[model samples]
Target: MDDKKPLKRHEALKPLSRQHHFGLLFSWKLRKGFAGNISVNRLKAYADWFFVHEIEPHFKLEEDHIFPILGVRDALIVRALKEHRRIERLFHDQDNPKNSLSLLEEELEAHIRFEERVLFAEIQKVATQQELKKIEEIHFEIGSKEEYMDTFWEKN
Candidate 1:
């Protein structure tokens, strides 16, 4: 059993946390695609769309606005930056779609878990109210959900 208490996310970070939910869902879709024997090209296509529509913007927002709460020298931010680059490379890698997508699926999920459980907790603890207010403004930039109709992950 898990021993840790749940971390209460500050309102300023809620938008990113919400985005993390979508990220988790993205990983789930990948798992479904693999299990259903969906085509690598088809899975990669969805990953491409999600990378543009979700991951790219999310990473920028975190890098620009959120992660700065703890500053660049912090170990958590360093790890997060490394993870972001790894995930970005996975998304960009097209030569081996199956291997790349599988790695993407696992790495992305683990990265989200780390942010939610550790990095954000540290940020929330250290950020000043003024800093959080600046971070809170970022909610306006969170893009609305654009429907992707492929539904390859859904049961037929």
Candidate 2:
């Protein structure tokens, strides 16, 4: 049974949370693709596109603007950075993309969940009003996602 009270995400974090929603959707699409028997090459192409466009920029945004609230030495930040590197490696593994994408699907979703539920909660607890405002200002481009033309996820 689940009894956790939902954290009311700070305004500064809402944009990232929106992006996390898409990240979860991305994972669901991967599962759909696998179930639909979509070709690994096709899935890898989409994963490559997403990693280049969304994941890279997203990671940079957190590392630059958000994670600093908790400092680089914080255990949560350390774990997040390690996850980021591991996810980057998973995204770039071309020789064994089938296994890699499968891992990526799981890894990315889990990473987003950890940030949303744990790290962000901790940050919000400690972040100053000015710090939150700074974060919001830096990452305030809501509803401006660049959509990929390939609809392999939909096909699957």
For each predicted model, how many residue pairs clash, with residues at least 3 apart or on different chains?
0, 0
How far off is residue 62 in model 2, in Å? 0.4
**TM-score quality measure for candidate 1:** 0.94
RMSD of 2: 1.8
**Clash pairs for candidate 2:** none
lDDT of 2 by residue, 1-156 (tens): 999887799988898898888889989998899988999988888888888777888888888888888999999999999999999999999789999999999999999999999999999999999999888778445433678787776774
Candidate 1 lDDT, tens digit per residue, 104-155? Answer: 9999999999999999989988999999998877563565488777889996
- Model 1: lowest-lDDT 10 consecutive positions: 136-145
